[model samples]
Target: MSTSTLDLAASLRAWGVIRTPLVRLREIEPSGVAIYAKCEWQQPTGSVKDRVAAAMVARAVADGALPPGARLVEASSGNTGIALARLAVMTGHPFTVVVPENVTAERIQLLTAFGAEVVFSPAEEGSNGAVRLAERLAADEGWVLLHQYENPANVDAHAVTTGPEIVEELERVDAFVACLGTGGTLMGVGRALRDVWPEVRVVAAEPPVGETIAGLRTLADGYVPPIFDPTALDGRLLVRLGDALAMLRRLVRTEGLPVGPSSGAAVHAALRVAERLPAGSVVVTVLPDGLERYLSTRVLELDAEEAGGLTLW
Candidate 1:
């Protein structure tokens, strides 16, 4: 618990809350379509979930449900847990994160280092198991449950922050691409884009069944977060883990951006969208996190065959 409230405030200061706009990639080879990335990975928690966590905690506090020093609790798939844990520490509240056992060891270690108490849910069951366990615990103790999967605050994060930032960054964004996890980023940004430019295509980069967070996949054997609406997206594409990893390497090797798996997935989707568009099309992709957290997995070592059976969960 050495991370003081001052540390959180200092971290927040390091990042200007009014996030910078998307930087246009004007230099791709055979440059017809331009691709830009909204670097949410640069957020304090190294995940876009930081916005949602901030929104969730602030909203709860505003509603008088969570007073100062109250405990916040939830189940997470790493990123959200880390964001909320940081929030709890900053807000003078405490938090317990219920997570599946199989999440990246780095994520678990990071969460623990941030002073969040961890409760391991069954890895086989995935995030849903954590959700179920969290629900029961919340019910039992009346904890302030920031149920992100269904929380409107999650959507608001993108709606108010990320969406506008993308629009401001790009001159003419033909399409928006992002990975679909809780569906907040896709839906919120989709709505904003459609409201502003109805012609803008909202592309969802979904993980293949094997690469998804367990129980979080509605297409496979899992539970869909209620907030997810298939019809909300203008387009949906499945990004393979191998192609995603390769793209991640490509970005790092070529563009010097060290992004994580979800960013890789979004970049793959961006390229696919770019392929179909006319010349000079602008495609913007949101990067969820940085690559520093993924080194333990040796993502670069994955070949097509080996990447196939390796579940991203």
Candidate 2:
């Protein structure tokens, strides 16, 4: 690796993107069944995507795919874009993010704050449209598209960092649960946990078909991320928007954990898995991001009647 890439790596470490806390949710689950969450929101950018962004950039730089000051582009709902934007600033790379127009205002502001050019895809088309548009723009402008959905580094990031951290903290993880976006977290961490406990169940919590959760997707929604392997998962749970919202509020009010919607979906699924497992079973889940990004959207503040009509971005 070049000196610049080395410096970038060092900067990432200095910025505190590595080794988030694996905290047990003592208040959220039964005493017999233990539930632990990887507090990824503690990352510098307050999202698990920070790890992916750092790993992707490092690998790209090392591979010479991203030479010094090369422009970077990506499609994100929010977290990944914000994460890569911060890294772009550190590396002196011009960054652009293609996002769905329906994304929260806080996300757009954060991207702009990091000096990233933001492009909006049609709101109705959702994130898939953003992905398509980003690909076209990257092709036309010759920008480096760090497509997180298919990036091998996305999986490698969790495999090396997130997975290892969980293994080191827990004696046995009978089940691993996470929200399914690009499926990198579940795939990578599931593989790692399974290596130690071969029977460890890997489950995904995804939104139902045609419904949208902030950072999760149903495989039935026409785009299966290339890095996702169905064989890696033991099961998939359909978490409704209301259920995720309710659980998000529960995590905040009951556990005092300010986590995002995806984390809510993850914990919802984790609870289901925990209920079915034996008394001594351990369940681990990933809290992908923080609640700050969703504040403008008022997801947490929605009343039950208002929540019924809520359209998720």
Candidate 3:
């Protein structure tokens, strides 16, 4: 690589948005299947969105879309906003994020800590509302909107980095599971994995219609991201909020993995997929973020009744 290219790579690594570990869950082993998780919370911003944010910012800079002192804005439930806030600081851009008012207090606090302005959308409308509000704000204020839902950079980030990392570590992957948000992770990683294991199943774990799981969305709920290709998925598992929380608790208590609700949902789906596969099948899932962002919400204390309902699909 050229000197400039080498320096750029070092800078990205220093920013803590590079490779993360793909670890086997030695304790939570199913009968004949091996399960692994990509521990993405290790990133500086404590979420897998760090990769998307870094890629979007770098693309914006290279394309000259982000001029000197340009303002940056995005719509996020939590992780993406926090990740973008940190990148905005590094790039010397003023940052703003639109989020549902019902998001956890810790998320708001983290965004503020990174000096990003927070705008509230109607909580009842969820993240789709946040996206609409962000679009208006970006247009009104002339802020550069790094729209994760439509941004190719979001998928490209995972395709180039996250997917390759997993394939490098695992010689054969039977199935890849992850939460369905903007669909970037599944789409990007799915494509990469398929390149090696042509028959590898790409599955998505999502909340059922009208249900809410932290950092997850269902396409049945009206808004499907433009980048999402439904044909790419082998299966779409509808995981309930309560079931996801139960799985999250299991990971923390049994597996010693302190991951967020989305991670829990992904693992829950992964296990379901594993049960149908042949013995010795390798199932890998992405843990999008850690538990720290959920501390203020008392997530660990939440019981099944308090967490809503449980259903498997």
Predicted structure 3: lDDT:
0.84
Per residue, candidate 2 scores C-alpha lDDT tens digits across 157-191 of 78877888899989999999998889989988988
lDDT by residue (tens digit), candidate 1, 35-87? 88887777887888888888777667656778777777899878999888888
- Quote the lDDT for 152 in model 1: 81
Greater TM-score among 1 and 2 belongs to 2
Q: Candidate 2: RMSD over Cα atoms? A: 3.5
On a 0 to 100 scale, what is the lDDT of residue 265 in model 2?
81
Clashing pairs in 3: none
Name the runs in model 3 displaced over 4 angstroms: 1-14, 212-221, 308-313
Once fitted onto the true fold, the runs of candidate 2 whose alpha carbons sit more than 4 angstroms away are 2-15, 212-221, 303-313
If scored against the real structure, what TM-score would every candidate get? 0.88, 0.91, 0.91
Clashing pairs in 1: 32-280
Q: Where is model 1 poorest over a 10-residue stretch in terms of lDDT?
A: 1-10
* Steric collisions counted per model: 1, 0, 0
